[model samples]
Target chain A: MESLLSYAFMQRALLAGFLISITCAILGVFLVLRRDAMIGHGLAHVTFGGVALGLFLYLTPLLVALGVAVFSALGILKLKERAGLYGDTAIGIISSLGMALGIILVSLAGSFNVDLFGYLFGNILAIDPEEVWMALILALVVLITIVLFYQEFVFLTFDPESARTSGVQVRRLDKLMAILTAVTVVLGMKVVGILLVSALLVMPAAAALQVARSFKEALMISASVAGISAIAGLVIAFYFDWPASGTIVAVSGLFFLVLFQARSYRKPAQEELNERV
Target chain B: MSTNSSLIHVDNVSFNFHGLKVLQDISFSISPGDFLALIGPNGSGKTTLIRIILGILKPSSGRIVLMGEEVHQFTQWQRIGYVPQKATLLDPYFPASVREVVAMGLISLKRFPRLLTRQDESSIDKALDRVGLKGLKSRRIGELSGGQQQRVFIARAIVNGPDVLFLDEPTAGVDADTQARFYDMLAELNRKEGLTIVLITHDFGIITKHANKVACLNQRLFFHGTHEEFCSSQAVQDLLRGEHHLVCHRH
Candidate 1:
């Protein structure tokens, strides 16, 4: 463990992984509660297309992916707000277009490049000092935004109709959320890879919801779960020489399953006790 | 009602959804402290009308003036409270206590960085006390019974002490005893607090006893007058007795 910490790559990987996971988990709580859980997955797919376009044009891939993902996220919001499309339907449509664009771009590039492969499977050890700094800055921005608009997001998620009638700027706040989610997804692609980044967002929140008694507890528990999973996954991957991204997602899945089982077992006993009363 | 003193003035309002005429040429004015019941058969545009009045849905034509300002330009939303339909149908796993849910009602009254004040806490307590749910303020909203959940939403709507409150189907699926108690609480709020209330419900038998005015709507305003006038209106009587079956139908 001491020698592992001495390695600069390992230090960068751990810092970036921990920060990205916490950001994803916090945003996941609101998205899952609002039934927009699929937005993360959709945005990740769009990022795939963005990466491909960047490679095709010989531009900075991460920056291009961030731009494409943010644009697509806003597009999804517009489709829902203006066209009245259902959330999942809009996500599905936009994500499909993104993936389609990616496939064409990849085919046109004439060969699957090693650089693109790193994004697909994630190479945390390959994450340089620049990407680590990017993760730190972006994660702080997302967390701060969540803190600033915490109450408004809660109201908007719980009952948008009531929130709007109460004079809350539901549309403006929704766009803010979309932009935040897009940023989180783009940053997360480096830590967990494009394919499994949604797991980092979804699993912790789903597990936390099982036992959380309040929204605050849910957010806290989710961040802890994700942070722990990231650390555990990294340690295990380093020791066993296994894939880090896949291991991280697997750990999150395991947390969800355990929490789900524990919640189910406790529920019947609590109901029986209530009946006795 | 005098237009100057009216809290809500609906002028030739009409709504269309996907080319389907939902409400047409509807006009009425609500006075301060008046308890108005909006009744109609299923799909008769009752919810749509209230949404329009609340600016949730824009009308196809005409205008709505709230508290002297046109609806589109009205910014004093803190003065308006709303309890939407199926308030009790919240997700059973939603992670919010009754207090937290009620605090959402106070969000509109605040600006950016909308933190609750010490006074806001006491107001939440008083609102819960008004709805007789002060003891369950910490309980998770999903844990409450259907009737209790309904009261939680009422507490939320009234937490801000708005001048006018709108409730859409507050008693649906509740037991008869709970339904009677709900109406009694609404009547007390309207009578003692002078809170103007616009309610949408199918329970005519009990609403007529509590509501001072009744508006019969089925894509058009059939009647808008004192409850006593509603009882004697021959047109409404015929609709209620006919296959329209406005009272017995459920949406």
Candidate 2:
């Protein structure tokens, strides 16, 4: 561990993991509860297109990915309204279109830019000071949005119709959530990569929900699961030379499996038997 | 009963969606301390009308005055509480404690960038106590029985201490005994707290017992009058007899 800390790239990787994991955990709680985990996957695919477009245009991929992701997120809302499609249909359409567009764009950029593989299966060690700053800014935005709209969000998350009747401005909150999700997805592409980003968004939250009885506890538990997995997974990867992103998501999934099994745990039944006896 | 303390006034209201006339030229007024039952046949615009009154949907034509302001311009939503139909429509697996769900009421009353104060906690406690679930505030909402879950939702609706409460089929899916008990609790709230309640229900059992006023609607204002008047109305007899009856009369 001490030797690993001496490497600047490992330090950068740890910071990147912390930023992505924490923000994803926070956003994931809402998304999982809303049953919109696919939005993360959809936006991540859109990020693929965004990254490919950036490569073709000789521009930074992260900024372009942000633009593409937010626009596509808003576009999903529009399609759901105008085409009268359910959310999954819209996401399916957009996500496929994004991947298709990305494939075409990457091919047009000539020679398939072997570095593009890094974005798919992430190379977290490649993160620089600029990507770290972007991740921090995005994390701040997501956390602040959650704090500002905490009540409205929880209301809408559980029961949107009742929320509307309570004058919570359900439509506005919907848009805000979609946009924030887009930003989070784009930022997540850094540490977890586009291919497995949604795993980071959903697994930790799902794990937390398995044992958490309250929303506040779920949030804290999810953040803990995600942050711990990210750091631990990255450290383990450093020793075994496994890919950081895959290792982190696998670890998150491991946490979920453990929590899922723990859900049925009850105090030793001897006490209950004694009371009944 | 005194009618001078009117809180909601609906004048010549009509609503339609996709060219389907859900309600036509319906009008009513809600007074403070009134336990009013909005009864109707299934799909008779009961929920729609309640939604319009709660400002969830706009009347296609007519105007609504709530708390002395036009519905469109009314901004004091904290003065009202709404418990929607199928309150249990949320997935049963969703995770939230009773306290967290009830505190959503106080949270909704807060504007952006504001934190919930200590007073919000006490209000939550009081609301939970009113629903008889104060002791189970830490329990998962889904862990409760169907009736207790409804009570938690009621607690959430009332935590804001609204002057007017609109409940849509709040006791649906419960057994008859539980429904009666639920209605009795509501009656206590109405009589003791003097909370104006607008209940949308298709069930007639509790209406005659608890509601002082009754509004029978089948896509139009069929009858709006005292419970005594409704009990004596021909429409009630026709409805009870299963006749293809459509009464458009108003009192």
Interface RMSD of 2: 5.6
- TM-scores of the candidates are 0.95, 0.94
Among all candidates shown, the one with the greatest TM-score: 1
TM-score of chain A in every predicted structure:
0.95, 0.94
Q: In the order shown, what is each candidate's alpha-carbon RMSD? A: 3.1, 3.9
> What are the chain B TM-scores of all models?
0.95, 0.92
Q: Residue-wise lDDT of candidate 2 within B38-133, one digit each (tens)?
A: 988898999999888877788899988888888878888788888888785656657798898898877557877547789888999999989888
Against the true structure, what is model 1's DockQ?
A: 0.55
Report the C-alpha lDDT of model 2 over A216-275, residue by residue, as the tens digit.
888999999989999999999999999899899999999999999998783343333223
- How many Å off is the CA of B18 in candidate 2? 2.9
CA error at residue B93 for candidate 1, angstroms: 1.0
What lDDT, from 0 to 1, does candidate 1 have?
0.89
Q: Residue pairs in steric clash, candidate 1?
A: none
